[model samples]
Target: MNLQAVKILFLKDLFLSRRQLFAYFAAGLASSALTTIPNPTVSFVGFLLMITVAIASGIHLIGTLMLSESTDQTRLFVMSMPISLLDYSVGKIAVILTTYLIPWSAMFASSAILTFVLPTSKHGSFAVLPAIFLFLLCAFLIQLVTAVVSESVGWTISVMVGCNVGLNVFFMQLFASPEISAAAKSDSVSWPPVLIQLLTVELLIAAGALVTAFIAQTRKRDLV
Candidate 1:
């Protein structure tokens, strides 16, 4: 891959994505604010908010990137440049990851602030970090899949939002079950299994996205 070309593509996408980035940040800040309220269930609420922020931000970023290419007709210009499709795709992914890192850091910082201001235990805050990271990784993978498969902004947004919402609902029900709740409430709960499950799901989503993107790129006569 051409490093210089990748850098150029990255910068171009970064500039193009500024407005969407701002929207993502705004949404994250709003969610964090809503969830930071002092309450007995603050930990659970905050964790959910962090997941929501990550998923929303990922969806917006990926949807906007994919849609903008067509809407702004940047696909043609970008494709005409001296860069491989793989390089361009890599650059886009790099830009997306970097953009996401900002909101992820914000979520972490917000959690830290809440932990300090509230009566949450240090162990609780520590536990949240890994969960947030796993949720963000899953969200990113979902967005990557939507980006590759969607042809329009609305469709992309729908897929991203639908996947996140559906997963959240399903997981919430599973975790909130009487038996699971009892186990989770206990201090001796084993998180490794949950973490492994999340990792496996994230990997599967990422693998599907890679396959879809590869097939789409291969079939297209033009690259962007």
Candidate 2:
């Protein structure tokens, strides 16, 4: 594996995503500010906005970054370089994960903190935010794999739509579970085994999808 090539590819991807990165940061800051508002209704709106912004940012950034090579007709230029398919895959994965995770984690943490401070009667539902985030991450990974493997704009969009809809289903199922709902009622951080197991599965699936995508790329003899 060419470490230098991987680094170059990663840096190039990051550079291309710099503008989206700025918008993500702005969204985070705006959401954070809204959370600080004293009114309960306004604060709740802020929380919802934060969730929306985080999900949208992840989708937009990853979608654009993954499709950029093909959309811009730069795949041939990139393929002509010293980079291998594995290296390129690893670089793109690293770039997208780093760009998406940091903001998502921050937003999740803030929501968790907010849940801890608010009354259980009103804010109990918010406690499941982290688990919901794990599901979102899983959904995002599906789109990532679609982007990496098919590289078809239409298929990628379909996967995104399906994942978005699936998110609601997963959220409802998880939140409705007695164990998870009970965990959400706690005043402190709760990491019940059930939730932990669920997260582990999501993480594993994401890792597997990434590996599969890398292998698929490596086997391709006719990449443009």
Candidate 3:
């Protein structure tokens, strides 16, 4: 692999994505505003916003990749290069992480600020960290799945929105309840059960993406 070429491609992709960083900040600000709301019944709402922001940010990153490749005709150029497909994939993942870290970090910091400023009888700021991590992991995994399945921008966005909406609803209904909130506060929310559910869902989504990426890479020649 040509390390210099990879570096150039990485930088180019980063520059393209930098243009969308404003949208990310807007999402972070929106999440921060939601956190500032002093509704006791809606303490979990901030976490919901956090999860939604993470998913939206992931979708935006993936959509940017697909859009840039198509718009600049860079996909064919990258594929035509001598670099291995694995290297290409790694470069894309690197770009995704670099582009996403800003918003994800902002979400975390904003959540911390909200936790302090908002009126919550319960102290669960530490719990927010793990939940944010899980949300991002799930978002990326879902992005991989959508990228493999959707050939166009419309389809990709539709699928991501649908999947993310469904996941958000499920989490809010199942885990964001007052009962669960109370449990989380007391550390009585059986860690084993919560971990099992989170791990199970995340692993399933990630395994699906890994399988799709493997299949896509193996058939790259055919795809071309």
Clash totals, every prediction: 0, 0, 0
* Top-scoring candidate (TM-score): 2
Tens-place lDDT per residue, model 1, 1-224, is 78999898888878988887877677667767766565647646766776777876776677567667777797778878787777777787778877887887777777657555654333333433445465556567656655754555766666666776766675776565555445444444345465546557766766776677656655665564
Q: Which scores greater on TM-score, model 1 or model 2?
A: 2
Off by over 4 Å in 1: 19-23, 26-30, 40-52, 112-117, 121-133, 177-195, 211-219
TM-score of each model, paired residue for residue:
0.72, 0.87, 0.71
Q: Whole-model lDDT, candidate 1?
A: 0.67
Ordered list by lDDT, greatest first: 2, 1, 3
Estimate the TM-score for candidate 2: 0.87
Per-residue CA lDDT of candidate 2, range 135-159, in tens?
Answer: 7777777788788888788998888
Q: Tell me the deviation in Å of residue 147 in model 1.
A: 1.9
RMSD in order of candidates: 3.9, 2.5, 4.0
**Candidate 2: where are CA atoms >4 Å away?**
36-38, 116-127
Residue pairs clashing, model 1: none
Superposition-based RMSD of candidate 3 using all C-alpha atoms, in angstroms: 4.0
